[model samples]
Target chain A: MSNPNMKLLYVVLALAILISILAPFLASSDPDGLESAAEKIIGEERFTELEEAEAAIDSPMPDYSIEGKGKLGEIIAICLGTIGILAISFGLGKIIKA
Target chain B: MHIPDSFMPLSQALIYWAIALPFIFMSLRWARRDMDEMKIPILAALSAGIFAIQALNIPIGMGTSGHMVGAALVAIIFGSPFAGVLVLTLVLLVQGIIFADGGITVMGANILNMGVISGSIGYYGFVALRKRNIDIKASAFIGAWLGLFISSIAAAIEMSLAGTFPLVPGIVAMGTFHFVIGIIGEGLITAIAIGAIAKARPDLVDDKAVEASKEVTL
Candidate 1:
């Protein structure tokens, strides 16, 4: 890639990282559209059941926020999440293009 | 929207998986046959961007918020709906395994809703508009919005079919909210990304050339 193109790529990646780190902090604690709609339509008790049902698997990082680590943990989780995405994308890219 | 296990019932989940797997396999084959090696890093970067953006939820109102899925953006950039499918699959997989945002049992449904349906339909929407000589930016905005809107509809349908809720109300609720988010959140994001790439590295985007070739044929 040319120097300018490389720089643009870096900018895009940097912007992505910034958003991943900062946006979570600003996000509302409310349920998203699907959840909110389900809650309104089916009522809270059933929605709670749906939420509880989500505990079918034990995840390393539930809800993308680690337990007991607070903000720092979230930052670390975001970094790890970014790395995980990059790894999968690059790995799949290579396999596809190979 | 991530569908948790047992959230959609086993039958609906399995059916969605059955629908998504063939498209995924075809996408892999398509990538192997058609992709240029030079585009790999770009795709990786874009996929990472999509994941990051998805994590960022912009508040819409009524104590709710929405995030940009970016499937349509990938479709438009890569000139292949399947590319969107693959990228979203990777993103969803990471979220499912690490974040536990989505359930393993309903991974198929998630992939189907976010990847297969949104990506393919969104790409085609862009293509169709481009063929009609619509401006690139406008085409992207409309395409992405439509894709997201349709995906929301599909999700609502799935929820209803699973007997989680009534179909009409779910459709109305999901559709109403996502319509706003789709146009405002997804459209702006897609347009800005495409605009930036077009300005900085026009050569990176294949959609323009694809449209040009189609124009000649038409």
Candidate 2:
């Protein structure tokens, strides 16, 4: 079926790819506000300990990158992850509406 | 922001889970009632777009960064705050399990803060403005900012209640930085995206029934 907003869809898809795939490389590798604040409030060591302590679950792409795959791999992992998320969300919505 | 596992007090997590579970149920019912099969693909596409946007963490100086949560964006565009909740919950769940960005145990707290709180705020903010005959695009921009602002405060409160930090300082820290960044990030993204949709497929921008329902306060 032809989408009425096919042009909009293409724009969205292009933007998503650029942000998820290309932009990650350029993004500052700094901790976010909460993490930065947490580090300041409770010394860096403790903060590190807190985050490190939570390594209980073995996530496939921990930290949004495949271990040892470096920059290119990070891009691929994040891109795939993004696509997977969309599929799950759309798939669920489809099933529910069905 | 995604809260880690042990950072959230178990009691607080349980409380948020209790609060958030009902919203999930309610949104499910809303989705069923408000959505038709034809809208599913568009809904999915929008959700996917939001997912990518959330992952893009823009630098806001001071060695701190913030990503677009996109709850407000989703809520405003979809014209259903419930849809926002569901979309955010899905994103957070995916990030939590696949990337370990958030913890499994604290998922409820994350969902409550990032999804329900922000989504409701954005939804109402837009609805309220639209009732006042505000421009749809302008309403969406304001709604996105207000929603993000309020959600940031809520997250700070959660951290305080969990004993991770002092209430006042936590609120100040989160509110200040996020307010500075979230307003611009959320406002521009939502406005631009909605603007694009308005240009390409104007029919989807403002549904009459959704606009009418906006008058009823949450």
Candidate 3:
């Protein structure tokens, strides 16, 4: 963080990680706009069915948490996700710029 | 505005993928030609921030919650919609594949709605507003709001096409819900983030845009 620009990057990354850590406890559990709209238009049963339908690939951390691991699990999952995207984006940028 | 796989039929999903591919290509070209070494860190930071913020949904009443999409923030900072597309595409990919927060089958539609539509509208809208002598923060707020609102409508239309919801009702519901979310979540956060970044690192942002905005204030 010697460079001012690097300092800015570190600050942003730190803030992002902090937010992710807090998200599990602070985030609302209610359905989002799309889900709410869909559930309203089509019955809740159908909406649930649609959501539960099988996907091509099963996510390692579904719903931002490890199964049966509760809020602690969510914090770990989301923090990892936040760091993962940063690393991936940085790596991709380096590759592209290279 | 993440559309799950079940919301869109395979045919419709493929159509969205067809539409999104060209934009993705153009964004890659932008990265190759226009993106310099200076922008790499900013891009990574913003992508991480967007991903993290999206995970924290705030309750917006009516038994629903919403989060900041961050398309406008990225576009405005980079002074290009392609930056929004590029970062958002990456974030959405991770969210879709790793968290299952969004669906893989309909990742194309998600990209189209959140990445392409939101990014294009957010950047262009901000520029258009600034041209009218509006303050930068205000312009960013309105731009972000408009981007999210319009993208929500686009998602509703796609859902209707998939026979998941009726067109008019879906539009009304999605539009109304996101309008509130945009105001409270997307618009406010975007304005705040941009203001903070511009204050701290004027060198990183678009010089002309920041200069013009400063001139407006002074």
Candidate 2: give the clashing pairs.
none
lDDT of 2 by residue, A37-56 (tens): 78777779988988888554
- Residue-wise lDDT of candidate 3 within A1-98, one digit each (tens)? 34445666789899999999999889998999999998898989999999899976899998899999998999999999999999998899889989
Per-candidate RMSD, Å:
1.9, 2.5, 2.4
TM-score for chain B of all predictions: 0.94, 0.93, 0.94
What stretches of model 3 exceed 4 Å from their correct place? A1-3, B207-218
Off by over 4 Å in 1: A1-8, B208-218
Best by the DockQ measure: 3
Preferred candidate (TM-score higher): 1 or 3: 3
- CA lDDT for candidate 2: 0.78
lDDT of 3 by residue, B1-218 (tens): 78888888888899889998899998888889877777788888899999999999999999999999987889888888888889989999999899998888799899989998887888788888877778878888999999999999999999988999999999999999999999988999988887787787765656466467768778
Give the C-alpha miss distance for residue B84 in model 1, angstroms. Answer: 0.3
TM-scores of all candidate predictions against the true structure: 0.94, 0.92, 0.95
Q: By the DockQ metric, which is better: model 1 or model 3?
A: 3
